[model samples]
Target: MLRRNVRLRREYLYRKSLEGKERLLYEKKRKIRQALEEGKPIPTELRNEEKALRSEIDLEDDQTAVPKSSIDDEYANASERDPKILLSTSRNPSSRLTQFVKELKFVFPNAQRINRGGQVISEIVEACRSHEFTDIVMVHEHRGEPDGLIVCHLPFGPTAYFGLHNVVTRHDIKDKKAVGTMSEAYPHLILHNFSTKLGERTSNILKYLFPVPKPDSKRIITFANQSDYISFRHHVYEKPGGPKSIELKEVGPRFELRLYQIKLGTLDQTEVQNEWVIRPYMNTTKKQKILGA
Candidate 1:
């Protein structure tokens, strides 16, 4: 049954990918048709310009380079005395992610670290239920991807100040679930592929990179595509307000939400995919003496 389920999921993903591709091509053709109908002449100069842009895009897609960081300076720059920043990561920490920790420690000085799979989900949920964390500040790398992970989710109201992360899951979660008073939704953050500052740098550095645009307005498009006569519909909303009655403008199909910010609009696809920012939301005048600060 498990094998069958996996096969079914693979099939569904394959079909979804093909449908998305077809819809993209159709949209491109539709835009071109609209331009022609608007009495816009397809100038030879414009054609040349488009060709040049396409060439650049193609070149970016072709180039693959691993980003470089000064690993030797990581430990030297950061002593053990920094306040810790917590974010989730796969159980097996990647070299790039460790390097990020090193750099974050160097910059912050009192850097504490939390792995994503340290605590059980139930325990973490219980902690939130109590007054453990009132304010949660998430500082994440803005990767231009559809499914960016979140570093923090604070309880509603104040006094819940426990930084409980390294939370684990036995299965992949894509839907929303009720976790105490708030719903622990999956994919807390989503950003667009071309909407990141790093995306601009990436596009500039790699000639063939095709960056997706950040939606001019914030709205979710329901009923945008139909495949095999099956229609999929859902509402995407603005965050911090939680699931309230909020209306936003519709964007392109590639857009996905990540935590509070739309994915590509906030995060960039760097070598380190799981790096995140975390801090307690507090207004204390008395400076907490951090371990290494």
Candidate 2:
């Protein structure tokens, strides 16, 4: 009876040890597969263990760890979140493509770089619509590298000249009506990059292309009403010797036009005067309101 008891205990211990070993092997396999699919280097010990396991276990049965399936899942999730950039290898399919993709991933951590089909442009358009990206930045290299183009064939419209940088310009209700058509909004000037000199030239170009509105008395009144009040002294002298030399004559309640100075496109002298006449109207209104009979 003593011998039989010892034998049963030993068998039970042996079975428990085997079960523990199988559990360890399964865990190691899972970790190694995860690292591989993520393009991470596996550790030496783990790699060796994986090799041995491959010889013993049928890899075909481990369909849960397929790299392609993992990539597809990642892409689907990324597409649902942000703009998707599909990199086309057709333009230049080289090993460098991998590094380029990695660089793009680094720049836009949320973006995914997928191998594109022949319909790359359409894919880009769809991505823009789904993701609602304001603008597209494309890296172009004529030396057989991939070039990202504005997908929808939509024009980039006129850029505002800020003297130091080109900014996007928007059309107002009046401006849109004056334009009369979408074709008129197409970019008349192309700037390769943002530069100070380019901005000056762009300003000049915009001024040349668009008709500048002349500012009148009504415009001045409207402009003044929208701005902070500023009082400036003006001489109301009749002539050189017509009346006693007027000194410190108050003439205006001009708006602080300097504060509201806009640099887009160009402005004429009349516009500038209209922009500055707020203070005079303000002064007159104050005089009437306070010193009325």
- Candidate 1 stretches with Cα past 4 Å from truth are 1-85, 105-111, 125-149, 157-293
In terms of lDDT, the poorest run of 10 residues in model 2 is 217-226
Which lDDT tens digits does candidate 1 get at residues 192-213?
Answer: 2433443332222211111222
Candidate 1 positional error at 193, Å:
19
Among these predictions, the greatest lDDT belongs to 2
| Candidate 1 worst ten-residue window by lDDT | 223-232
Residue 108 CA error for candidate 2 (Å)? 2.9
How does candidate 2 score on lDDT? 0.32
- In candidate 1, clashing pairs total 52
Where model 2 places Cα greater than 4 Å from the true spot, the runs are 1-92, 135-293
In model 2, how large is the Cα lDDT of residue 69? 22
lDDT of 2 by residue, 31-118 (tens): 7767878999886777657778665555546554332321122123322332333333334445443444444343222344555445
